[model samples]
Target: MSYRAVLRTPHALRTFLAALVGRLSYGVVFVSLTVAITVATGSYAVAGGAIALFGLGGVLVAPLRAGLVDRYGPRRVLPPLAVTYAGLLAGLAATTWRPGTPGWVLIVLAAVAGAAAPPLGPVMRAMWSQLLPDEAGRQRAFALDTVVEELLFVTGPLVAGLCIAAGAPAAGVALAAALVLTGTLAMVSSPVARAWPRVEAGAVVAVRVNRARLEPVLVASGLGLGLGALGLLIVAFATERDQTAAVAWIEAALAAGSAVGGIAYGARTWAASQRTQLALLVVALAGVLAVAGLAPGVAALAAAAALAGLFVAPTLTIAYLLADRSVPAAARTRAGTWVNTAFNAGSSGGSAAVGLLISRAPLPVCFAAAAIPLLLSAVLPALHERVDQQVEADPGAEHDDDRLEHLAGEAAG
Candidate 1:
């Protein structure tokens, strides 16, 4: 299916556009908050702490927020979360309006705002599963979504930069508040979102963490870890050569590669199962990253980075698709959220891990180390496929495995 077909899916354009508007706030808020807090308190340390707390708040509660949506539907849950999140952003803007605002106040407001932030991305992915029931259409939609989200992150910082240049850092925060609030309200107003059925309060089913489900999270986490380390490693590489300006161009190349790769992956149908595809993609990404560390110059490194990035979006899109397929419709949102949460957590951990390694080890060794996670993670899906093949070869074994899974689910519940 073409991208146009995905857009033409009934109500897809309106709902997706609205979600994009709200998701854009995510790209804007972090930069705005960091700059605003720094300007208010005149301390990068405090600004950094506030951003950390904000991220922690969001990550910690993401599953719970998604679970709420699973039970109550978006129309009933999204508005309140959006309103509270926007209100906190506005409050944060007010506090950061003038110099000498207490650092503690800014930190507290940011954390609360993040905690209240709506899970528009996860919810929208769930909606896509509903709107595009066909696998081909769903693949195209997810690719389009991932690519646009990448663009939003790139654009968001520029918007914040503009606000900063205008000498109104807090205005960026206020703008983010308006965007999310308005966009979420408009999204939920759509017939698809409004008609989303709510699960009964006690109707939640236990989703077993089998190989099918766990493999996606593992791969996603590994991919995030490798990419996260690559970001800082590239900067370090450039700094060592006194070519720091090249860092932006290298990062831009990576983004460009991902966008191109996503469009290409979605535009065609593949014969490989999602599992095999994910495993191969991760292996390719790992190999490219390892080779990137061997590049002798900034230009060569940028080319390798672009090559490594070609698999990034497709890997993530497949991970989400795996997650969506692992659970029933009612639990898909939470499942996808878990994959996302794993990726973000892995990214943060990767950055910290690489920071320590980069200082103590050779640059090439550090790059190889960064690729370790991806290499190890690629084993999971391959192993899962082997086990599935074994089960297929033995009918009694398959039956027993199903029974075991059922019992596990029961125990989990």
Candidate 2:
């Protein structure tokens, strides 16, 4: 089915647009907060600390927040979180309006703001799962979602830059607050969000971590690790050649390639299972990334980056699809959140790990090292399938599995 068909699915356009508006705030808040904190405290160190805390708060609390959405439903849960988050952001902006705000205060506020940040992306994906039950339609929806999110991230910084150029960094924060609150309220007002049934608090069972469930999270982390390392690697590559300005063009090429790849991937229905597709895509991505280090010049490196980028969105979209299909409806949001958290955590770890190696190793070696995670993770899908086959081979295994799931659910309740 075409993307147009995906949009034509009842309530799809309304729900997706509302979610996008809220998600755009996520794109805007981090950079705005960093600049605002730095200007207020006059220390990049303080800014860095605040940003770290902000990320820590959001990442650490994400699964829990997603769980709440799963239990209580978005209609009941999202508004309060959005209100608290926006309020914190507004307060943070107010504090940064004047110089000499205590660094500790800024750090504390940012941490709380992040903790209160709504899980709009996961919630939206869950809604998509509900809205589009047909596999082909769902795939298109996810691809469109991923591509648009990529654009938002790219556009968000430019929006912040404009605010910064106007000498009102606080405006960006306030604007982010407005965007999130408005978008969330609008989203919840939609039939899709409102129609989502709240699982009784006692109805939820713990999510089972079978091979099928775990594979997507691992693959997502690997993808994030490679992409994260590539960012710094690109910068380092340009710096060594005394052509730092080329870094932006190279990154742009990567994003452009991803967007095109995502659209094309969604436009066609694949014959392979998501797991098989995921493995092949990761292998292709890893091979390209490894070859990227051998580029003869900036132009060649950009081309390699673009080639590697072709696999990114498709890989992630498949990972998310696998994640959604791995669990019961009540656990779907949490499952997707785990994938998101893994990717973010992997990105942070990749950047840190590569930072230690970049100065000590050749650029080619660093690139190869970065590709290692993707290469290793590419095997997980096959392993997952093997486990599935094993389970299916035992006739009594299905009953036992159901019992275990019931017991786990009771314990969770």
Candidate 3:
């Protein structure tokens, strides 16, 4: 779980670089698309709406797409999707270049483009879990991945910013498209990514309706809801303060702080006792809410947002770790999809709710709204542990220990 582990392990290094390339492309596409839309339509609302549509499209498509990944493997789904996503970006750019394009046309294009985007986060996570081959390694890998994601987000927008400054925001989108197409094709071709066989469609079809199989997904849905609220509050604050132009800066600072926190988490050898990580989550959440509520201008908000993000990444990282342990191997990708879908849906809903709040009251009201989820995250760990212990201690839990050992071994490999 230390830098030395990443330093010494060739598999981890290869897997990480591959994952990082895919992620960088994803970030670049988002920034480029948003900036392009804003400039082309001459409306910030249009750009915001396009981004929102993207989120909604992902939520709608991800669960089904995940089922495909589980059935056909990420190898089959990811590469073609990357190529199609690139084409879509190119099409979007073309649409913008034409004069007198209708807003509705842009909207439809955005919606379709959003739906076409790859599920890089889930795919990379699954790869990391497989690459590391043990619980400790998985934990460290997740922490490292979290940090990498933060860094990617920070840099993605900078690239977009530079592209926009160059008088052709399409440059970023074009570059993103190329990166995604190349990276996905190359990564999916790797021996590591192709290790698992595709699940039989019949088996996946039968399991689709099993409610018993969806418990972890449901819980993660709740977590995603809380985060969605946080996203809304941030948007409201950024928009109301006329800091829309600096949105990337704010995001970069927040991500930078989260990366720092995750690096600290990853650098350690022993896992922080679940109890300690939970306590830190609570303290961090409280600090985030307090800072957001203060509304001490952009600088203060930036610092607070970063502080809030510090714990946010670690909390989710732990959740994914628990998920890896809980779900059956055959169901891993599907289960991971559910967790991601829940997060997307929750964030969308949270944003909608806070947008309403912002319409009614001052910006600080958004922060107050963020507090509810932070408080819930603070409490969720204890409840989650108890439920987990109960399941583990059940007398009828046949082969549970052996299964855990096997899973740990898989992670360690």
Candidate 4:
């Protein structure tokens, strides 16, 4: 596979592995914080709110953080942030561990830690374009990244679960903190990472990109992710009846499906446009997830979840691929951050909105509510494809107008 060649590149393996470890926290911190807080306070409400604040921290920081990575590069920007990120995680652990700590303290600490979230994913993904510029190689690299992300999604909760079981939820949080610190240091020190320019000086450079062409796919994919978040909430509701044991299995199944899909999708390139594939997969997910809410047992729910997950990694890979291909190198970091921030906002909003609805509505209704966004997601791509086709069809129209103008000039002469 081209991926093998990609890894053979200088410093590729080291950078990729470090990135995998660091980005694992993408899924871990939320699980660790939520579980640990719930265990301490015996309140899911507080746990949920705390986790949301953490995400909000990232959302608030993404644009600025991305710009820094772009201007100064990861080596210069990440090391300090890595130290700060680990410190914040440690602080959160310490603050939340106290028995009588005010709830507000935990919330504030979570936000601060989240704002300090590492930029490993963005930097690493950006590096892939530089590392493997070919279409095949780049797609394979993205697929590998997506698969690792799926593993993180599955393993995050499992690791946290084991830590919580062995000690308390704080153990999980502490472990995650250590991973971030270790992984961040490793990533920044990698040869490729260190080789990146420290910073570009003089007036700040900004590149104007034509988003008119890319917006539809971006919106469609973003909404698809948001709907995926809605499905996650439905799964939460499915497990609400104290089916704690089943929750892990269901989540595992979902993660597994995404991993499998990514591997399979990356095995061969298809002729279809990325937008077409993205739209189709997301539309398919809408139906599967709506039915998933009606699953009669844990086993059934697990199967449904897996089916819903089948589309996730591929969709994300395409979205990431599009982001890389669409934006100029100068805007790479900002573009990556834009995609992430948008997706996070969508996912968090979906979960928050569904969390509110879950208490009052039937599980099926909540699941169906999630599907509504997916359906809307389908519309964006469809329109995008039509626009693309129209553009293709009228390619010569402008040239013809130019020809007419030339003839008019000749006649005037």
- Each prediction's whole-model lDDT (CA): 0.90, 0.89, 0.68, 0.74
Full candidate order by lDDT, most accurate first: 1, 2, 4, 3
What is the TM-score of each predicted model, taking all chains together?
0.95, 0.93, 0.81, 0.86
Off by over 4 Å in 4: 38-48, 197-199, 207-233, 236-244, 294-297, 359-362, 398-413
Please list all clashing residue pairs in model 3, or write none if there are none. Answer: 132-411, 133-410, 133-411, 133-412, 133-413, 134-411, 134-412, 228-347
Listing every candidate in turn, what is its Cα RMSD in Å to the true structure after a full C-alpha superposition? 3.8, 5.1, 6.6, 6.3
Tens digit per residue, CA lDDT, model 4, 59-118: 899878888888888877888887887787787777666556667778888888888887
Regions more than 4 Å wrong, model 1: 398-413
Kindly list the per-residue Cα lDDT of model 3 for residues 304-375, writing each as its tens digit.
778877776776676566565556555566666776676667666766677677777776666676566555
Better of 2 and 4 by TM-score: 2
Badly placed stretches (over 4 Å) of model 3 are 43-49, 197-202, 205-251, 269-283, 295-300, 362-365, 377-380, 387-413
lDDT of each residue in 60-105, candidate 2, tens digit only: 9998999899988999889999999999999999999889789999
- What does candidate 1's lDDT look like per residue over 285-366, in tens digits? 9999987888999999989988877899899899999899889888878998998989998999999999999989999999
Ranking by TM-score: 1, 2, 4, 3
> In candidate 4, which residue pairs clash?
none
